[model samples]
Target: MQPFDAKPLSDGDEQLLAALLDGMEAGLCAFDRDGVITHWNSEAVRILGWSADDAVGRRGFSGWAARTADAHDVQTRLLGAMDAPGRQVHEFALLTKDGHRVLVRTQSAAVQGQDGRPAGVYCAFSEVHAQIDLERSIALSEALFDDASWGVVLIDADLRPAVVNAHAARLLRTGRDTLLGRPLGDLLEQGLEELETALQHVLAEGSPPVPSELWLSLRGDESAKRHCWRSGFVRLGSPLGEEPVPLGVGWLFLDVTEAKLAEQEGSLLRFRHNQLHRAGRTASECEDPVEAATTYLDFALAGFADHALVDLAGDDGRLVRAASTPEGSSGPCLPVPVGTIPVAYGAAHPVLQAVERIGTVRASFGALAAAEPASRARIDEWAAARRWPEGTVHGLSTVLRSRGRTLGAVTFLRGAGRRLFDRSDAAYAEDVAVRVAAALDLAQQLG
Candidate 1:
């Protein structure tokens, strides 16, 4: 009911300013020469529980005081600065309109008249001091969600979608627009069955959430089983600045498919490689090259092959088959000609080319057919005898080449479709070839 104005308060202006201050959420008041309340605003009344009519002329420090346990001396220090007018501004607290105390910052200064005489002290109070104390807490919460390595989603207290970050969007394979405001249950169905289970566990447990590995079939397609994720859930504080309680749950999902695949492949490779190493070690202990070659062939056969032939190279562009599993191993160099032995086309012909090339080569039956008509016919004949699909056999050949000369070829015959050799498998095969090449070189030296 008063007009607002700048300094040197008019009765109408003071009344209007008082009305505006009362309307503000922040508290405002002034003190006279005796450090007594001369003006009080409605916010002061609401916050400190003091009516302007009752507070006027009352000792500001004695009759009206606001304090919190955290800042006990703030009000005392502000009022004590009245004697030292040099300190233009001071901050403190006042008793709220209610008996309750709150943290507040006050700007107080001596009010001087035009003649330069000290007339009173004016103080404006604000409540943003509490917000400063909460900054670190807010930052910690943000870090929990943003820095998480897994995909995280926040569901509000009402069970509505509050927020889902980039990771969650990718895991769910949906845009933020499609995810937000939707129920967590609905989204979980569209995402992964594992996600729904995790959600239910969080709701039922009502405790700190747990971690789980989930395989998703959200796409309902051939690729559905490929979608696997590891997830975690934790109850979190509200994003609103209110006093925090567990108002929502955070769900984090991490893609573990690659890690799992790598683990499996590594295990297999290690198993096969270990077998090769053990065989070599055993043969060396016995000082038998023939036994070592037999052992190596067995190990090689265990990898995508039913049979293997480890042979020394002859000057005649043929193999001297030293050892073969199932016995009666023949080659052109031995009683049985290696050139006459039947090989299924494309079944691991790469091993031969690799041996011939003195490097690594990967080939299909077609590649083998292209290499030699006689070799192709031999493979076709074997395929027909086995009553197997011709395409099921691939011939891989790796040359035992050491110091750039072809020492021999360690050949493998892979049965079809049990396992398609990947690049890693090929690389491992190359490594075995190199080792065999070294072994051949050493054998020749011993001879």
Candidate 2:
């Protein structure tokens, strides 16, 4: 058997070990088999206001460091770890040198000797509140990554995803592991600049009081569906640093696309309804019913379409242009020239389809409108064949009906830069068509 003094650690090694123990964030102390204090680190001094010189040579935490009534029980529990298989946890009310009482939670493990016999016990401890705070932080992180309803993401300073929660991963349409360390630009087809700018602002200025909305397009899809997300951000800074040093950003977002769209649709419908009411009131003042019908068409054009054409069913069952917005520039709806020829619309035209079915008909150039030069030429020919104005790329034709009889059909046109008309737009156009149809029917009755 080797003697304890035969191969004792060198002074330098002892100093290094002491330095390592002192640098730890936790308070550490060790006791020998005989219950004599053998080690005391700087954290212990900082916690209990006891110097190493005073703490190292003491027996168990009795008289000075613990209540006289509780010292014996606390010592017994700490020393019990020497015979325990693993670490034993306990809480003790410890007394600082200044006579302040601090409740501490401790984990004590047995240290073994050369013969595998229990030689001593080492206990690491911290203030109870600090220990509970650490546990709370870990639990919160786990909950967010596993079961949160909204998307939660941790983005590092380099603007890359560091940690992504399940909800966020699903929203991004990718696996959590696949998104980590990837730039946001790779995931978004548009609005990357706005997102980055918002992130930078959070890192520099801290969190904003209210959540912000961001609309973005996803990559690798041609449907061009844009999504709205209501997002909040918090700047994370290192707790250990003296000055606030940016660690990353915590981003939380909820999908609000449906809600936002509903709000916009409701607002637009209200505006259109108000316009209709105003147009009706203004039209009643005009003595000429034809002029009143044009006034109705003019009011319908605001924020609805770039151009609109009103056709009347002629005696030959063909459509003749009654009123139209001027081409090449914006203008008021004017009656067509007297004795003008009817529009040369073919059988399969959108206007003809609406007239035949007495319902709304939607048409567009489709992919050809956005295609190369050759396909663009085809678009021009397609519009010309329908007798539509040049540069028209999208169209919606709604049948006009009044007094249970089809009055005519009104066609709305959008240029190449505008979006293709959707069902909602068709609905709004139908509402406008009702007013225009009544006005046109009155004109026919008056004439």
Candidate 3:
């Protein structure tokens, strides 16, 4: 094999190399085998406040770049890398041109010659504090993605999930890779509009002063259960850009569904208690016992349901409608004049079931079919067969009992727009039934 011959670098080549080294972000300096400085880049000059003309011919850092007491050790460590393998890391306290001390971290590597011998060494360095700050930022980012208790998601500028942490992936009920780049609507069954609005607001107007709580439903669940998230958002921008340029948004959230539900339940309970108290006060002033019974029904409808009906047990095991809200729309409960008139409610009706079992009974039309026209006809027929008012989709019947005896049943009806009756609704209806039963028992005794 022929030995390769290398030509010396042209003046243009040297100038180009010098410009490249001068433009580097890290300070760079090269030393010869004889311990003379051969090259000093612009970053090194800027850090030490010395010109390349003065630095390139200096033998070592002693007496100028470093304190005399520390210079010998620093120079020995820097020069030691010339004979060592790979790179060597070291920290040194160096003197700037203005005599201020600056601590720096340096990485030194041996520069090999064509004969496979160490020709010199080159060192790259940056301020120790700056390097430490960079390391801390990287550590924080890693911790957020790996070990955070709350959910963390990095959403791109287009509002798609770019990165999802483990906590966030679990909340989304998906793998991290599956959520990436997918639209927010694809993951959430509802509340996408509100989420996107919040993300866009963060990108355009910066973060809001307070974190927001969002209620959303998940896809592919039969219950269609809703969840509440206490979410915070921050807009990420490009640090390298001259002006603030939006990169994406960072979202952190925690599942607050149970807490929020408890809060709402407490508030609802308080309001219902107040309503019951108010109804008792107003009913006491009524001239007729039946009027007071209707007053209880009117107050119970405030935030519980759209309409209410009170039926009283009549002769031959039949029930008669005693009072009810308006049939066309929501209104105060009025006493029905159907005296001794037994309603044609079948045996299997929810209201009749409640009376027979002495417990609350709940029923709904169940999810409507996709076909609108046919589904509408089916719903109407379903409502009519049960003698419910128009648009009633959900019904709750609580048995009206007074002193261990069943008086009748009171039914609460909700329109198609409202949610189905759950256990909480049953409990509230039972509370109202207690009040209604007392007033009706009094009416029966007085009549």
Candidate 4:
């Protein structure tokens, strides 16, 4: 590569200097120590509506560029930069060639001579409104990265975090320096593919018009389910290029997890309540009370769980599996034979726990997250040992009571794909158990 200063003025250096000055985004002009204009670029002419031929060689903006009264003070302040130790800034109202007034902000500095003394002053200026706009942009950026409540991150074109603001770092549960350059997969347990796809789309086609909601599982926490975020993106491009060059993506997001959970809980509650109402209407038509009891279980399994069982306490103090959902699934629970043997439940099983405590008992899979092939095999063995249907990972067993007597227990089962039953789920299950216990009590009285 050739250096910029490889050529002297005799060899086209003067033309190069002129080209550099004219290509600048800001207006430029130079004056001699006596305050006579010696140079003016095209931008300077564009700003004041004066061509170089008319602006250069002018002894100062006395009658043409400025009001005669203000011109003297403007000239004194501008020229004083020649003796000033550093660049000096001033605001002046100058006249354009069309007789219109323009207020400009300028920075003036002394131009050194060959003998290292101040020979002249060179000033660069822009419209005052434009200067204020630039300052406002800088201030907004500082505030967003420092004090904004939500997360803000700059994702480079490579899709790694280039800059993470303080709020973003805290949300990510790491320091700003630690998050930089880390791949999205390392930070997210799930949803990494979806997030990277969105970023790639922004780099190729620009930001989407509408915001997106993503459910993300971050790596640091294991007890939590997926978190919800309402995110907006802006595609950043280089302003200096003739054609827009993609720089990165600006990602802003607010944590909407609590709101999202509340919304889901409300929807689920309405659904479960509706299912209970529907079950009551349907069960009233059944001639046999045992069939009515199982009908309630079928309705409850619609969204509540994968499978269920009803075990009734026998006269011998043993529990018999009197009703259960079909092995394949989605079918109604069927009644077992009258003389069927008792279920082989151990002393400490969740169903037994519910009967012993006369309350709901919840149990987790006790399996690792991100289950590998070996871990999955172990889970299968664990499920088989518990005698639950193939993939059961969660259980909520509630005691069944009719009047003042503890009649039996009803257990709701969930597969590996579902979340563990929470307090709300236990409450719903107990509600279903109450209806089933009433039907069972009626069947015994009729028999």
Candidate 5:
């Protein structure tokens, strides 16, 4: 690079000045100290349909550009900027080439002479509506990044955060500057590929008409929860380029995890309630009380677990497996007489715990689920050691109690594909156990 050579305004410099002024987006005009127009750019011609030949050397818009009534006030404001310390702002109407009136907003500043004195005034103006539109855009941009309640983020073409608002920073649990230029995968423990796909799609196509619901897991948080975000995206493009150039994406989102969870809970509750109702009606049609118990268990297992067991507290305090849902080849509960063969459940077993406490006991395969590259053989061995099905990873055991007497226990088992049994599962299991126990109690009394 070479230093720019400074010289007095020769013909070459004058041509350079003309090119620079014509390239500007704003309409520009310059007036000498005597209020005679000395320069006019192509933008000024485009705005008011007056060419440089028609505008330059004209005296202060008194005849052509402005009506005679408004010319005096307009010229006074334009020339007054030469005496002002800073730019002067004014809005006035001017006449076009065909005598049409155009409202314009102008910014005028004094042009300094080589002798350090005010030599002329240069005015840059645009249509009033266009100026208002630009101002509104700037105001909206500021407000969204500062005062908006939701999270807003600007993503660059690299799919990394370029700018993050305060709410977005808070939601991400980091400082605004800390998130910048960081890959989204750093913040998301899961769904990184899905989110990146969505961003890439936005960069290629335009925004979708509706917002998307994304379930993401936050990394580095011990409690790793599935957080649902209701997100909206917009593809950003550069306005200066002749062709539309993709900048990035504007992402706005709100955490809707709690709401979605509540909705799922409500839907789940309704489903369980319907299952319970249908189970009772079906159990009523059973001829044998034991058959009624199996019917209820069948209804409960539909959406709850993969397998089930019904162990009745037998004579002499032993637990005999009365019935069970098939688990591959295992059926500790039998074709034998219902009370003859007792299941060999260890003392620390979930069923034993539920029976002793007269409450629910939930157990899961500890740490095995979290281990990377967990082996199917190991899972089988673990389940076999506990006398469970080959793939069982979670279990919920609840005591079957009716009329203040404990009859036995009902255990629901889940495989690795399902989430562990939670409190809501226990509550629903208890409800099923209550009905099963009542049917068993009636059978024992009749016997």
Candidate 6:
């Protein structure tokens, strides 16, 4: 019985009303005491295909009769509810304008006159399709959370946890229930600048938030550690009448800790390997023996080595440490005997032999194959034939020269620990040997 205000509502309220109607996902209609349609929303039109033009001045059942037989039943319920006490709800089958049958949940309330008598009926309806749809959606969402290899979390506008999937709960090393509705920043509980930055970025990009990557350091665990993730944001509804606020973000997280570690390790390996590769190529490019060895050594170190020595074959036919450090290291003294002095030469030794014997650039892991009979015999015979000092062992890649001819041979001893190298590492060493051989050949031809 309150006076109706004709004044216009704010754009925000109009938008809010539209949002409310849209949010209902329910078909709604209002009828006067005479059963004439006064208002009908889009959902009603969508379900019945009958708008205000079709039902405003006409009987509700007659116009919608083509849509459903249940229209008469709904009218009966409304008439009874108008005569009776309070509000009521009912479920019934409805036929759409397209001749499709659907289950609908309907609620109707009385609109009172100035005398407090029943004036009309305001009814609202919701299609029950979402009942089954929601259940299936929930099941699938749960499955995704449980089965996913990465972590997932749903947060509120205040960045509070509305839901934390199983994987995310485990990643944080906490229980799902315990973490729910708690502030995400609080849960992180660390002064991680990157994590803070990522969260801020997500919220700053409103509605359909952008995906972001971040590193997290979880605390209050048995052991604190770092975890990386790629996260995203999605908006969720408030209640019913409220404006669609900027809700929290959804995080789709991937654990990339292992991948990152692998990338770093690979980079280091490639750097060392490339040094050897470059050294060999440089040797081949320069034809002078001194120049080739010097160039090869330069490429070998590539600013990575603390020292280097290029031992060329001496006039006495003994493999001698001819080229020493550019930085003037006292080691690899001339005539000190290559057999006694040792350093990690990699596969250059065997590669040297291959190049010498085959008359082409060769490469092998000499120290790695030192246990093999072929390698052992070659090394022993070379050293014994020279009648060199007892400690001197032939480099696996040794540049042997007979009659002013420099044949390639290299002795690769492991530096300090004599670490056992893997295949990839060995392959890198062999590549260097090939380059050194090419250089030696070029040097001989040029001479």
The models' CA-based lDDT, in order, is 0.59, 0.87, 0.87, 0.87, 0.87, 0.57
lDDT (Cα, tens digit) per residue for candidate 4, span 334-432: 898876588888668899899999999998775443232236677677667766787777888999999999998998888776777889999999999
Q: Tell me the tens digit of each residue's lDDT in model 3 across 87-200.
A: 999999999999999999999998777887787888899999888999999999999999899999999999999989999999989999999999888898778789999999
Tens digits of per-residue lDDT for model 1, 308-408? 55666666655566444442232221112345443342433444566556765544444324223345456566655532334335545566778868776
Instruction: Give me the runs in candidate 5 sitting further than 4 Å from their true place.
Output: 1-16, 98-100, 329-339, 367-382
The residue-level lDDT of candidate 5 at 112 comes to 82
RMSD of each: 12.2, 3.3, 3.6, 3.3, 3.7, 12.7
After superposition, candidate 3 runs with Cα above 4 Å error: 1-19, 113-116, 367-374
- Model 6: lowest-lDDT 10 consecutive positions: 328-337
- Model 4 ranges off by over 4 Å: 1-8, 220-225, 367-377
Query: lDDT at 147 for candidate 1?
Result: 61
Q: For candidate 2, lDDT tens digit of each residue in 1-447? A: 111222587788777887889998999988888778888889999999998888886889888889898899989999999999898999999999999999999999988887778888889999999999999999999999999999999999999999999999999889999999999998987778999999999988998899999998787657767899999999999888789899889999999999999999899889988988999999999988778878887888888778889898987777889888888777888888655477888878899899999999999887435322245577678778877777788899999999999988999987776778888889888987888888889888977
My TM-score estimates for the predictions, one after another, are 0.47, 0.89, 0.91, 0.94, 0.91, 0.47
lDDT of 2 at 15: 78
- The TM-score, computed over Cα atoms with residue i paired to residue i, of candidate 5 is 0.91
Clashing pairs in model 4?
none
Worst 10 residues of 3 by lDDT: 367-376
The per-residue C-alpha lDDT of model 3 at residue 54 equals 79
> How many residue pairs in model 1 have overlapping backbones?
41
